[model samples]
Target: MSMKDDLNKLNETVKQYRDELRVQMHLAQQDVRDEWDDLDEYWDKFRQKLDDIRHDADGVGQDTRETAYNLGEELKAGYERIRKRLK
Candidate 1:
């Protein structure tokens, strides 16, 4: 093949790869968003439970506190992971 024809073929190959990469990245972003949405739902439930536990000072026990603390930590870590992925 002529040099010009080879250059054209190379450019077309690069364009195809770029388009594929764009689609893959778009799908990945959507997956991440869906995961974050699911996590947010759970995070809200955990927050409510934590608030209830805090409010019930007399009923609050070590186990309850520990559970709440652990859940909060998990949510925090999840948020950090999503944030890092977005960046």
Candidate 2:
């Protein structure tokens, strides 16, 4: 597939993961939120990494988008676990 098609697929996959993350965040306990705040700086750094990686394919390199998307999935999984604990 072309780079544009690959990018489109990546975008859609990331969107789904992002949506799940939002759901998990919504269901997460206040205590969990507080705990997350303890690592707020870490998350901020991660966000910066992601931001830097997101750009035209040439500017960022081939794996940049994929790596960011994988990080997003990992974050979502963490949020999902916290949400489950809140249940």
Candidate 3:
């Protein structure tokens, strides 16, 4: 093919790749948002449990509190990671 024809082909290929990438990115964003929604639900449950424990301080065991704390930290880290990825 002539140089001009080759350049045109390359340009077309790049455009196709870019279009595909955009669609993939959009699908990925939706998946991430769905994951975040699920995490938010879990977070709400965790918060409710923490509040219950706080209200009944003496009834809650040390192990339970520690587990909750660790889980909360993990959730926070996961959330931060997702936020960073979105950015």
Candidate 4:
């Protein structure tokens, strides 16, 4: 297979695993997953910020890099905090 095809398959595999994880999380009633899901707004914002960074890399300089990095760190921190509260 070509490199592109291989990469596409890998991407699809990763997506499938993520979907399976969501199903398992729901079945297990994992509070962390639920909280993560509820934080959709923040997640969406983060995603948009990343996309903007990619599109406008000219302005995504040092400060924007730091901001994006910190946002990701904060999100991960929040996820960890909620995870600790999980039953």
Candidate 5:
């Protein structure tokens, strides 16, 4: 698939996981909550990057595209970590 398709799929998955975790965050430890806060900030930035890329695909550079994809992957992993901890 193309980078746009890949990022969109990743975005959806990450959002779903994030929503699930948010519901269970009350059970999370302080450190986990802190990490969540950091990831939440990152998520906003990543979403903005994704939006920029989607709106102006030709204007965005390869490096920026890669960075956004990498950030999404990291966010996915971070969400999974918190999910495991909550369980």
Candidate 6:
């Protein structure tokens, strides 16, 4: 085949892969959105915990602080997972 014909064939293959990947990427995004929605409660609780701690830092017990810290860490990890999925 001529150089032009070979280039055309390669271009077609790339286009096919690009189209397939586009669909897969869209599905991946939906999965990520679902994961985020699942984390919504955790996010809300984490925010509320922080607000409580800020409002009553002096009155907050050690266990309460620890619980808030653990929840924050969990949220961070969950967000990191979503980030990696997007990548």
Which TM-score value belongs to model 6? Answer: 0.64
- Candidate lDDT (C-alpha), each: 0.56, 0.56, 0.56, 0.54, 0.93, 0.60
In model 3, where do residues sit more than 4 Å from their true spots?
1-28
Q: Candidate 1: minimum summed lDDT over ten consecutive residues — where?
A: 2-11
Who wins the TM-score comparison? 5
For 53-83, candidate 6 gives per-residue lDDT tens digits of 6688788777766666666666666666765
TM-score of each: 0.60, 0.47, 0.59, 0.50, 0.94, 0.64
Q: Which of the two candidates, 2 or 5, achieves a greater TM-score against the reference?
A: 5
Give the worst 10-residue stretch by lDDT in candidate 2. Answer: 37-46
lDDT per residue (tens digit) for residues 1-87 in model 5 = 988889889999999999999999998889999999999998998999998898999999988889899999999999999998998
Question: Once model 2 is optimally superposed onto the true structure by TM-score, how far is the C-alpha of residue 32 displaced, in angstroms?
Answer: 5.6
* Ten-residue region with minimum lDDT total, candidate 3: 2-11
Task: Give the clashing pairs for model 2.
Answer: none
With candidate 2 superimposed using the best TM-score fit, by how many Å does residue 42's alpha carbon deviate from the native? 5.7
Indicate which candidate wins on lDDT.
Answer: 5
lDDT of 4: 0.54
Which residue pairs does candidate 6 place in steric collision? none
| lDDT at 87, model 1 | 58
Higher-scoring candidate on TM-score, 4 or 5: 5
Please give the lDDT score for candidate 5.
Answer: 0.93
Error of 2 at 5 (Å): 11
lDDT (tens digit, per residue) of candidate 1 on 1-87: 743343344334433433444444454577776766766675666666556764785687766655655555565566556655755
Model 4 misses residue 17 by how many Å?
13
Score candidate 3 by TM-score against the native. Answer: 0.59
lDDT of 3 by residue, 1-87 (tens): 743343344334433433444444464677776766666675665566566666877787776666555546555555655655666
Error of 3 at 7 (Å): 60
